[model samples]
Target: MTNDRGTSSRRIFAGIAGGFLVSTVMTTPASAQDDPQHGLADIIVTAQRTEGRLQDTPVSVALLSGEELATRGISDPAALQGSLPAVQFQPVGDVLANIRGIGTFNLQPGADAAIAYNVDDIYIAHATGLTPVFFDLARIEALRGPQGTLYGRNTNAGAINIITNRPRLGRLSAAAQVQAGNYDLIATEAMLNLPLGETVAVRISGATQKHDGYMRDGHNDADIYAGRIRLLFAPDQGTELLLTGEYSNQSGLGAGGSSPCLATFAVAGCNRKGWDAYAGNETPVPDDFRSVENIGINGQLAHDFTWATLTAIASWRRVDYASLTTTGDANIPFGDFGYKPSNANQLFTGEVRLNSLASSPVQWVVGAYYSREKMTNRIDRTFLSDTLLGVSEVLDRYRATSRALFGQVTVPLGSRIRLTGGLRFTDEEKSASGVATNYFVVPAASIATGGAESHSGLTWKAGIEADLARASLAYASVSTGFKSGGVNQTPAGFGIPSSYAPERITAYQAGVKNRFLDNKLQVNAEVFYYRYTGFQELLNIFAPGYLAFYTVNSQKARVYGGEIEVVAMPSPDDRFEASLALLDTRFTRFDLTSFGGADYSGNELRNAPPVTANVAYQHRFRLGSAGELTPRIETVISDKYYTDAINSVAGQQASYTQTSASLRYLSANGGWSLTGWVRNLENEAVIYSYFGGRGYPLAPRTYGVTLRFETR
Candidate 1:
C-alpha cells in the first residue's frame, strides 16, 4: 500500500533547482559575529544543563551541525526523518522515535521510551544504543515539549541530545573517510586527536559499514561495527575531567524479513493502499536476521568554584539482542518458525550538578539522579509441526530502580522579564520474573502473574521569559512528564498483565525565538498542548486462536502541536532551510475489551501525523584553484498518517514526497575532500511498517562516493 515518489525524480529536482537559483548571489551568515558570513551560527545549547543561546532557548530546538551532518548526507539515527518538526522515525528493531505525538510501539521488556535519548549527558536506555553509523559528531539537539523541568523520566515525548566530539586540550586533530555506494556499499571512517601536554587529551573514533539490501527478495543485508574512546583532563584554574568508552556491533537482514503487503484497493481511511500491486501475500519470512551488541561507559566532572559550579555524571550500559521471525501463515512458510525474539540489557546512571555563580539577578540549578535497570527476555515458541502443533516457551525477567531530586530557578523581572521555576522528584521500582514452557519444552508455570510495583512522582516546570531583542526571545511554559510502570512480557499463552501504570503528561507551551536581518535570519516557533493521563498503549489483541500482546490503558488523550523553523543566509554563498509541523492527535478515551468491545473514541494516534514539511537548498562554488564546490537540494513532505490504534487495513502512511541530492568538494587549505551523493531521489516506495501490514523497505535509489582526509 505504498508507492509514489515518482515523476522523473520531480523533474530531476526541478532541473537542479532551476540552475542553481539563477547563478547564485549572496553573502554573510555563518552566525555573523562581524561576519563569519554575517549570520546564523551561534548555537550553544545544553538544553538547560546550563549554557544557552539558541535564539535564547525558548525550547523548540532543532540544531544539527557537524557541518550540517556532512552537508546533508546524514548518517544514521533512522535518517532523522524530516530532521525536526514533528520528528518521527520508526525503523523498528529498536528505533522508534516520535515527538509531538508521543512514541513507543512496544519493544517489549515492559516497554518504556516516550522519547528521551541522550549521549553526552548519559541516559540511553536501549534503542540499541543509537547511531548505527553516524561518525564523530559534535551536535544534534531536538527538544520539543514536556521535558519535565530539565529532562527527567521518559520525558513524555521530547528530548534527544547527542553531542559527541570532545577531547581537545592542546589540539592535534586528524580524520579520515572512505565510502562507495549502491547495494554493495562500503564505508570506513577514522579519527584521532591526541595531545598529551599541559594536562592530557586523547580521542579515537572508528566506524565500518556494509550494505546490500532493498528487499524484493535477495534477503536484506548489512553489517556494522563501531568504536570510540575519549578522555580529557585538566586540573588548573577550575578543574575538569571527562572519560568515555563506547562500542557497537550489529548484523542485519532483519528489518526486511517482516514484509507483508496487500492493499491494492482496500477502502478504509487514511490512504489505504495509495496505489496498486501485490494482493496475493506470500513472502513467508526466510532470511530474517538481527544481532546487536553494545557496551558503554561515561564519566564527567567539572568544577569552577568562582562562587559555585560543580557537576558530575556517570553512566554504564550494555545491550544484546537477537531476532528471527515468521509470525505464521504468510501462506505457510515452513509452518511458523521459532526461537526469534531475544534481549538482554543492563544500564546504570548517576547525576549530580549545582550552580549559582554570577549573583545579582539570581540564577540557580541543582540536581541528583540515579538509575539501575536489568532486563532479560527470550521468547521461543517451541516449535515442532508437520501437524504436530506445539507452542509455548517463554522467559522474562525485569528489574528497575530510579531516584531523583531536582531544582531550578531564575529571577529578574526588570531588564526584560524573566521568571522560571522547576522541580522534579521521582522514585520508582519495578520487578518481574517468569518462565513458561510445555509444548514439549516441559515446565509450564510461574509467569509472575503480578509481583513488585512502585511509583512516585512530581514533575514540574513553570516558565516565562522575554528578551525580545539582542537576538530575540519570548517563551512561556508549563510542563510535567514521567513514564514508568512495568511487567508484561506477554506470551506464555498470553495470560496478560504482569503490571502496568505510570503514564502521565501535562504540557502547554508557547515560544518565539528569532534572529533577523543582521543575523541572516533564524526563526523558531512552537505551540504545544498535551494531556495524557494513562496513555500507555500497545494493543494487538486478536484472540480466537492465538496472537495477543498487551499493555493497554488509554483513558484519555489529546496532543496538540505546531512547529516552525526557518533559517536563511541569503549571502555568504547561499543557504536556506525551512520546516513546519502541525499535528492534532486524538483518542479521548479508548476501551478495548480485548478486541471485541472496542470504543476507540476519536481514534488517530498511532505514529500520529497531521502534516509535516521541509525544504533546503545550498550553494557555494569557487573552483578557482580547483577547490570548493557545493551544490545541494532537499525536500520532504508528508501527511496522511495512521499506523494503527484501531485504524486498520494495514494502517496507512500515504501522502509522500521525498528528494535528496548533493555535490561537494573542498581542498585548498583544507586537507582534502570529495563527495557525491543521492538518496531516495524519488525512487521512493519507502514503507517500514508492522502490526498487520508488515512492510519494511527503505533504500531505493542510492548513489555514492566519498573520500576525505583532514589534519590540524
Candidate 2:
C-alpha cells in the first residue's frame, strides 16, 4: 500500500478550515448564538500510570472510551480486532493481538504473548485469562510500539492497558445493564460503589455473557462470568491503600477444526473443503474449561515536603488458570477418538516505585520490578482401531523469571519546549523440559524423557520527546524490543526444535499531535521505522517421510508505518472520528537451507496487511422535556493481505470491509438507557488466517440490544 499520509495533510487542513468558516458564521447570527455550541471534550487516559489528558502524553497511544466500546459491542478483547487502525488481532483460536505488524503466534501452553495485557497495573499472564468479560471500565489504552520501560516483560510488541473505574468515596452509586442479541446471546453487567467508614470505600463489578455458536456442532459457543471487588482506605491526608480481587470462569466448546481443501481454486464460501467441513465433525471434549483467579493489593503513601512530594507504591499479584481441549487428525474421517490435552499456568509479580512530582522544570521517576511465571502441560493421544490400540503422552513444562530497573526524566526547557528521556534494563531467564511416552501392543512400551534447556538475555530501551506548543508536539525515540526463545513442541512426525534465537527489533519513530479550529477538531499523526534482526520465521521444511514446520532466525526485515487520527465535533450533539494507517513491511534478507532446498530470501512477511483504516460517527439529539437519543455508526476497512510469506499464488484473501452501528436512548434523569447495535452489517465473507492447510473464516454478522439503569 502507498504511504500517502502527507498527501492527506491538505485534506485535513481543509476540514479544519471549513469548520472554522462555519463557526465564524454561526456566532454572528442571533439564533446561532442561542443554539448550543459544538466542541471537543477532553480525553483522559492512564497511559503513563498517572491519569492525564491524552493530548499531553508524549507516548503514541490510541484511546477507546467506554462509550465507544459499548457502541461497538466490544465485551471482549477479541472484538477489538480492526477497531483501531494500528491494531490487528489474528483470530486463530484465541485472539492474538498485533501492534504495528508484530505479534506472537502461539496460544499453546508454556508460551508467552509478545503483547502484554495490564489491567489496573496488574499483569494478565495468560492469553485465555484476557478473554474474560469487560465491564465498568474507565478506558482502554493501546500504546503502540515497545513499552518495555514501564510495562515490564513480554512487551516485545506493545502493551494494552485497561483502566477500570476506581472506588468512589462519600458516595453511593450503582449501575446495571442487560444485553440480548442474535443467536441466543445474552449478557448482563452490574457495578456498585459504596462508602463504609470515614476513610474506607469499596466498589464491586460483575458480568455474565453467553452466546450460541456461529458454526455447526455448537462449536464457538461462549459462556463467560467474571467479577471484581476493589477496596480503598485513606487513613491520612497523604496516604492511601487499595486492594482488589477478581475471578473469571469460562466454559464452552473451543474452535472447530478445519478441513483440508480438496481443490486449490475453490471460490469464496465454497464448503467442499476448509474449516467448514470439520465444523460438525468434532464433539464436545469434556474438561474443556478455562478459569482464572487473581488477587492483588497495592498501597500508595505520599509525604509532602517543601521541595517535592515523596510517593511509594508496593503491589503483588498472582494468577492461576487451567484449560483442556481435544486434538483431531488431519483430513481422514476416523471415528471421533483423538488426543485430549490439558494445561495450567501460574504467575506472580511485584513492583515498587518512587517518583518526584514538583512544580519545578524537572521531573523524574525510578522503579524496580520482579515477576515469575510457570506453566505445565500434558497431552495424551488414545487411538482405537479395529486391530490395535495405542496410547501416546507428552508433558511439557516451562518457567520464566524476570527483573528490571527503570527510570525516566522530563525537563521543560522553556514555555514552548520540553525534553524527556527514559531507560530500562531487564534480565530475563527461561527454561523448558519435555517427556514423551508411547505404549502399543506387542507386549512392549517405550518411554523417552528429556532434560530442560535454559536461556537468558538482557535488554534495554532509550527514548526522547519534545513539546513544541500547547497544540502541537513532536517526539523521536529509539526503542528496543525482545521476544524470548523456546523449544518447539510439535512431535517429530511434524517438526523438531532447531534452537531458534531470540527475536529483536530496534524501532525509531517521530510524531506530531495538533489541534485546530479552536479545539473543535484534533489531529494526531506518527511515523515509525523499524530494523529487525534475528527475526523468527516459521518455515515448512520437508524431511524424509515427514513434513516439519520449525522456527528459524533467518531473516532481516524493515517496517515503516504511520497512523493519523482526527476527532471532530461540528455541533454539541454531533461527533466524528476517523483514522488511517499505512504500513510498508518486507523481509530485507531471508536465507534458509534445509535438505529440500538451499535458501529463500527477500520473501514478503506472511499475514502482514499493508493498509488499514477506521472511521466512526455519532450524534446525540435532545427530546425537549423528555430525554436524549444517540446514534453511532462505524466502518473498518483493510487492504488485501497474504496468509503466507511466499505470497502464495492463490491463497490470498482479497481486501474486505466490516461495519457496525448502534443507537441508544437515555432518560432525561440519566438513570436509564436503551441501546441497540449491529455488527458486521455487510456480512462480508472475511478470512483472518489459515490453519492446518485450510482457511478459517471470520465470524458472521451479529446483532444485539442492551438496557441500562443507573443511580447515584
Candidate 3:
C-alpha cells in the first residue's frame, strides 16, 4: 500500500508542477524587473544570540514577520506546520512541536521536549506556555538542527525564538483590528504605546477570539483571551532595563476526534477519503472540554563597557491546563470512557552573559544559566453515562533542576573566512512521586512509588563560514545535543526500571545562501545528517493484573535531510516564494521488550514525511488616487506519514494538499485595510493522532473577513 501511495503522490505532484510552470510563464515577463524603490527586503535575526542579517547567519533559520502571520490568519504555533519547512505541530493534551523529525511523544511531567520554544530570549519549560503569545510579535525564527552551545539542553531538534514588539522610548501609537467570519467567528486585537518620559516608555497589547465549533456535533470550538505589557527604562547611554508581563486564558470544546474508518478499515465511513463530518462509529462524551491559563514575567538588564557588554535575564512562569476526552473504544463493556488530565506547572530561570564589542576583531560571548521546573499532574478515568462511574485515577508530582555554563567564539581567519567554536557543560537532576488507584475493584486498591536521579553531559559545536561573493555565503558545521534522563514513578513490585538514560545526537550540516538579480531573487539550500543514540520512547506494560507506563532507550537511529528555499520578486507588484524539504529517517535498532518483544527496527519515525513542499504567489494591482488590491494563493503538500512509533495502518495519514487564498485592499495612507480570506479550499482534513482505532483530525475549511486600523 505504501508503494502504491508513493506512485500516486508522484502523479499528483506532476500536475501541480505543470500548473505552477504555466502560471509563472503567464504572469512574469522578461522585461519585468524590480524597480529601484522595491526588492527583497532584508530580515534581521538573532539566531546566534546577536543581531545580524539573516543571510549572514551560519545557522539554518526560517523567519516570518508578524505582518505575514496576520495576513495568512495564523494565530498560534500549531498553524505553522503547513507554512514552514521541516516542521510539524500537534495539539493533544498539550502542544507537541517537531522539527527535522525530532520531537516529544511522552506527556509525563518528567519528560522534556526535543525542540525548545522560547519567547523574548527566555525559554519556555513547557509547551502550554507557547500557545497564546503569537500576537504583537516582531518576528518568529525557526532554527533547525541542534542548538548546542547558545541553547544548552532539550534542543536536540532545534529552537523556536519568538521576539515580541518592544516599547519605543519616543513614540506614541495605537492600533486595532477586528475580524468576522463563517462559523460565527469573531476576533479583535488592539495595541497601545506611550512615552512616559525622556527615558521611559510602555507598550500594551491584547487579543480576544471566539468562534463556534466546526464539527457536526459542535465539538471543535475556540475561545481565547491574551494580553501583554512591556516597560523600558534607559536613563543613560550605557545602561538599559526592560520588564515584561503577560497573561492568557483559553477555554472551549477544543479539537474533536473523527475517524474515516475503524481499525481494519471496515466500519462506518469506510469508503471515505478525507474529512468525514463526524460520521464515525465513535461518539463524543458529554461535557467534553479543554482549558489552559498561563502567567509569565521576565526582566532583562544590560550595561555596556568599553571592551564588552554584560547582560542579565530572569524569568518566572506558571501554567495550568486540563482536558476531558473520550477513549472512543466500542469494545469496552458499557461504552466509550472519559479521560481527564490536569496539570499545574511552574518554571524559574536566570542567566548572566557578556559579549565582546561588535568592533572587536574576534567576537566572543560567555554565559551561565540555571532553571528549575515543578509540576503536579493528575489523570482520572470515568464511565461516560448519565451517572458518572469512577474507574481509575493517578496523581504525580515531578521536579527538575538544571545548570549550565556556555561560551562561543568567532575568529576571523582572513578577509572572507571565519572560524567558530563553542562548548557547554550541563548538570541536571530529576525526582518524581506518584500514586495510582483503581476504583473498579471492590475496595479500591492503591499503590505508591517514588525515586530520584542525576545526570550531566558536555555538548559542543565547530564550524567555518566563507564569503562566496559580495552577497553570498557558504558554511558547514557539526554539533552535539543532550536531553536529561528521568525517573519512572511506578511501584517497584512491577519490576520496571527505576530510571531511563539520557538521549544524545550528533549532527553535521552544510548550507549556502545567495542573492542574485540585484537582490530581486534570493535562494538558500542546506543538507544535514544526524546520528541519534539512546532514543527515549514511552512504553506501556500490561502485567498480570495491572498496567504500568515507563520510558526506555531505543538502540539507535539515522536521519538525513535537505531543504531548498526560493523567493523571487520579478517586479514590485509580483512576488513568488517556495520551499521544499526531503527527509529520510529510520530506527536502525528498536526492540520493544514489553510489547511481546516486537522489533520496530527499520521503521520510519512518526510525522517525518519523506517529501514536503510549500508554495505561495501574490500580485498587487495599483489603483491611482485610491487604495491597492492584492490577491494571494498558497498550497502545502506532504507525503504519507505515520502518527505512532509502531507505524500501524490505522495511524498512517495519507499524502494530501491543503490550499488557501486571500484578497486584501489597503488605503493609500496604509492606516486602514480590509482582507477576505478562505483556508482549506478543498476541506482537507488531515489526522494528527490515532487512539482506540480512531483518528483525530485537524481544522476544516473556513472563510473570514478582517478589518485593521492604525494611528501614526
Write the number of the candidate with greater TM-score, choosing between 1 and 3. Answer: 3
lDDT against the true structure, each candidate: 0.71, 0.66, 0.79
409 in model 1: Cα distance from truth in Å? 12
Best by TM-score: 3
Error of 3 at 360 (Å): 2.3
Q: Which 10 residues in a row give candidate 3 its minimum summed lDDT?
A: 22-31
Instruction: Output the TM-score of candidate 2.
Output: 0.86
What ordering of candidates by lDDT runs from best to worst? 3, 1, 2
Report the C-alpha lDDT of model 2 over 447-558, residue by residue, as the tens digit.
4433333444445555555555446566677777776665554444333453556777787876666665666777777777788887765655433322334566656888
For all predicted structures, in order, the TM-scores are: 0.33, 0.86, 0.92
Full-model lDDT, candidate 2: 0.66
All candidates: CA RMSD in angstroms? 24.3, 5.4, 4.4
What's the true lDDT of residue 553 in model 3? 76
Choose 2 or 3, whichever is better by TM-score.
Answer: 3
C-alpha lDDT of candidate 3 relative to the true structure: 0.79
Give the TM-score comparing model 3 with the true structure, all chains together.
0.92
Worst lDDT run of 10 residues, candidate 2, spans: 27-36
